[model samples]
Target: MNRTPEPELMQIPSQVRAYADADFSRSDSMVVKSLEKFLKKAGRTLNKNDLIFDMACGPGNIAERIAKNWPFVNVVGIDGSKEMLNEAENRLSLNLTKNLSYELIDINSIASGEIHFPFKADLLVSNSALHHFHDPYCFWGALKKLGKTKCIHIHRDLIRPASDEKAFELKEKHLSNSPEILKKDFYASLKASFTVDEVSQQLVDAGLSQLEVFQVDELYFEIIGCI
Candidate 1:
């Protein structure tokens, strides 16, 4: 798959991490709900003792949910933004058990062998953050190194149809009932969303032929690969 720059590529500016973290905390519930559904559909099992990594885990919202839902499993949330990490730490403080933790790490630098984690993860997940990758292939390669047993789930906004008219029509038709927050999120996601073919091609290019790629809705796409 040819790497293409996302249309709405936006950086998480250093100054806004705290504010962004709060926003993420509020939206965490929705994210968890969506992810839980996807996890069930993927049918990938996680043992109570399994170690999971939440890459690009802004504010550790998903981490908190996973910890709550599967108390026996270990959940580590990683993000490049320190401010975001602080927010995540604060939010998860009350919920902290031995099984949950957070770290500030850049995905790109990790893939380039500039940094390393102490352990390999059993499952690596990212939500609405994959499109921000400047070089997704590098990230995929890093995930592969983490462990083949890992399952990756990315729930992000998808680009509408290739045709502008089709995209607009679909957006208008389906997004009418979406709340303001969701509408905003949906648009951003659509702008950053990749087509199923695009995602599959990424997997193929990364030599992940066994990967499973699918669309969950008009606005969301998923990729599940096991090494």
Candidate 2:
């Protein structure tokens, strides 16, 4: 099936609200678990000065988890959508999330030299970020600018199904209970996603072949490595 591109930012009020209200704890937890497992294997310990960026972070779900998991390290959730970030901030308490913050940034701007974030990332993580970019190179090019030398990465995204029938089956199988708007968006995202082979080729094209791409399950794929 040919890929269908969705808007990069979740700016619609109803759409953003639906996404923020949806329960993603199950899949979201998987991202944290994978990152922790990866770090343990590498035997790398995070410190106060370490900077962790959650790229294209929507509702800050994964970013919050990482910040709380490692309270000493600074965590910033960067997203292009104000509505999404607002929802993310609503869930954040200054008292509870002292080490956590949000940045309004269009990731593609970094690649174009329009936005220059002063600090480089020690660890950059993104969940459901890659498929949003119409041009995949925009995603990788911006990442290269943001990450420090040897920065650790863990990015997870839905894998495009082989056909529209397969995509619908996966959507209903996974999110049958979700709201109509949420379900619609989820279906669009699944259609917009890339396969493991395509993502692997993208990594090579981006000069990031050091990263490893593998299917995590039927619905998603993970990219992990140091760059």
Candidate 3:
């Protein structure tokens, strides 16, 4: 499948609402499990007062899970989509986590240094978000800004399949129960994703060669390391 980057923001109200209300528990549970397993492998632990920053946190699904796992840890989810953020805030309000917050920020602007986060991030994580950056440089630039010395960084996204047929097959296998909109979104994301070699080269170009890029599962690859 060729790389076809989707729009950075989910601008349509219905689309955003549909995505927010979609049941992603099956896939999201896999994300949280992978995060915990990899974080442990990196020899890090979430401190009681630690701050976690999740980029492109659509509807706060993954961020909510992180907050739940470590009740004391603070979580901040940043996204450019107002509708998505609104949905995230709504869901968060219904939860017990007072430490999880949502922010309306353009990640590209933040990556370009046009905007800056007020506080230093203890851990920076992004899941299934990297593929949305039409310009890979923006993604690398953002990583450079977030990946400070001693700050843990881990990013995971679907890997582009070798063939379009394979991409469709994977989507059917994984997202069979999902709504048509979400299934379409997943297919688009898979096509937009960078291959292993492409991502490795991106790391090298960004001076992030110290980080490790590895295929973590059948359909996903992760870029993980500390700065």
Candidate 2 residue lDDT tens string, 1-227: 99999999889999999999899998899999999899899898889999999999998999999998999999999999999998889889644699999999999999888999898999999999999999999999999999999899999999999999999998899999999999899999999999999999999999999999999999899999898
Residue-by-residue lDDT tens digits, candidate 1, 149-183:
54554444354466555555666776676455544
Clashes of each: 6, 0, 0
Score candidate 3 by TM-score against the native.
Answer: 0.92
Model 3 / residue 8 / CA error / Å: 1.1
Estimated TM-score per prediction?
Answer: 0.73, 0.98, 0.92
lDDT of 2: 0.94
Q: For residues 67-99, could you state the per-residue lDDT of candidate 3 as single tens digits?
A: 888888988998999988999988877875888
Q: Extract clashing residue pairs from model 1.
A: 157-189, 157-193, 158-189, 158-190, 158-193, 159-193
Q: Candidate 1: which stretches are off by over 4 Å?
A: 1-45, 148-189
- What do the candidate models score in CA lDDT, each in turn? 0.65, 0.94, 0.84
